[model samples]
Target: MTSHRNPAHSLNWHPDWSSGGDLTLLSSDEIAFSVPSRPILAVSPALRPGAGGLLPLPLSLRLVLYFLDLALYGQLDFLGPSDNYLTDVLSLAGWLDSLGATSLINLLLVSGRAQRWPLAVEFLLGARLRRTDLCREALNRFNDDGRWRDTVWQPPGTVSDFATLCPRALPLDLWSSVDRRFMWAWVVADVPDTPPSFGLGDKFLEIYQTP
Candidate 1:
């Protein structure tokens, strides 16, 4: 059950974790038992494991991307309200949802995978995303209530703040919110809590600002 961290991609791995505890549905609710039904299944070349028919994962890394693959194949029932197979992963004793934003995006923002499962929002977020349009797609996927909805097991957030994105969405756009604090999960994942005017949007902006 040991894990290693790769902060650049914000991913952690347990190279030899091949045990039976891998429930059909993870507690994180990132993947599910049905994904073949979606018509616009999102795919990415970046996620491919390369020519060997296996992800040429980093040396000594035996990461089990089982949940990720399930989403790729479209087994995403956790996103829908109809699905009730989820098991709570978060253990906050006295925490409340006043902080807003329970999007799975927050979990990915911090844990690389939705390991802890944030539940402030009513729906799951991130499940069928194209790496290229992460932000707008997220914005477009927002329900009429202005909250992001989940319908699949897409990665919660960009692999890194520096991950490529559209020039116009601008990283700064993610802030300016009283709720949606999950988005902040990315800004503070590596560190702790948002720093004073840390202006993470600027870091995001810088990524796009450069050639």
Candidate 2:
């Protein structure tokens, strides 16, 4: 007796086409799994402005912005601690408040250590210093700490009088021993190392003597 073999089963299987593999063979569904159909979420853009992006303004300013926005449009409170500090934007807010655009007086007060002393002083003197009580308070604090000599070598008018009223908090001997150069350098250059007194003094003297 002769036996006949099925053509499909008799054929040899090869995986590579170049190696005589059949291209018509279909892969079993069990070998391949279905892919997910969920859509991808898009990212939102940043809202803050300036070199450091957002949060560059002091804490007080951020708080003021929050309350001001609430008072302005009867809109939902959106400003928060995470809000960015745009100085120009804040200045406009101040102007709007000045015109009674909002009920809340938007005053961004910055209170920090001596690290911000010079900048604070310049800001205060710019236009806000005309508000005498606030100016006096800031000056009094500086003089009371014996930091006036080091921080503000030649302070504006009446500042010297305030300094005289508040005797140096530290001992005279201690104050004398403390390197003036180092103190000035720390204030001006934000440097940590002690510098030469004569050199520092000469450099600062020009600034102090300037009209």
Candidate 3:
């Protein structure tokens, strides 16, 4: 949150989405925006309005507006004010599962909006959302690029290069998920169980036995 500003004259409201709305959503930064609740309520049963006061969300005004704008209007280009901002939008959508906005983001990504964006953006969003379906969508794109076999699987680069695939910092849990599922798929397809033995394997086994 930045410095608190006057709610009435805050610079944080959405310029296009703040009018003709039925709900007053206040963000943690004390910025308020008027957004329609009908579309959201139709899709999400988790965001019911409270008795009579404005709804408060524990997100920045930018994020809240982005979520509402995307969810209600199916707008994909209104990314908020920051570098690599889609990551933040995906994070907020993933956290608010009850909002039912994740599907909209997923749809936009798979429906060609993500082609202009980094392919890794979809992959990282999948990990953030904990959706294997989304993860597979990203994986299929990578596979289509011929990177799965040539670069990701049998690489001069290592499996850790998958981390490099992400333009932003990778969280430990998401990385673990990617390793377990994403890399495991490649390993299963690429690794052979045969008589061929490698010195590095022997060395690793020896180190494990010594410990």
lDDT of each: 0.28, 0.28, 0.36
- lDDT per residue for candidate 3 within 1-211, as digits (tens), equals 3332222321223323334544434433332334554222111112334421223443333343334334222232211232222233333343444433375465444433344443444554455445556666766676566543222223233445444443244444444334323342221222232211223222212211221
Report the lDDT tens digits of candidate 2 across residue range 18-69: 3331112123211111113311111111112221322465423443343232
TM-scores of all predicted structures = 0.25, 0.23, 0.27
Off by over 4 Å in 3: 1-96, 99-102, 106-112, 147-211
Q: Alpha carbon lDDT of residue 111, candidate 2?
A: 20
Per-residue lDDT of candidate 1, residues 59-168 (tens digit): 11112233332322223223222212111111110122222234335423443333323222112221112122444444444432464323212233443432233344
- lDDT of the structure predicted as candidate 3: 0.36
Q: List candidate 2 segments past 4 Å from native.
A: 1-137, 143-193
Candidate 2 backbone collisions, by pair: none
What local lDDT does model 3 show for residue 194? 22
Local distance difference test, candidate 2: 0.28
Order of candidate numbers by lDDT, starting with the best:
3, 1, 2
lDDT, candidate 1, at 211: 31
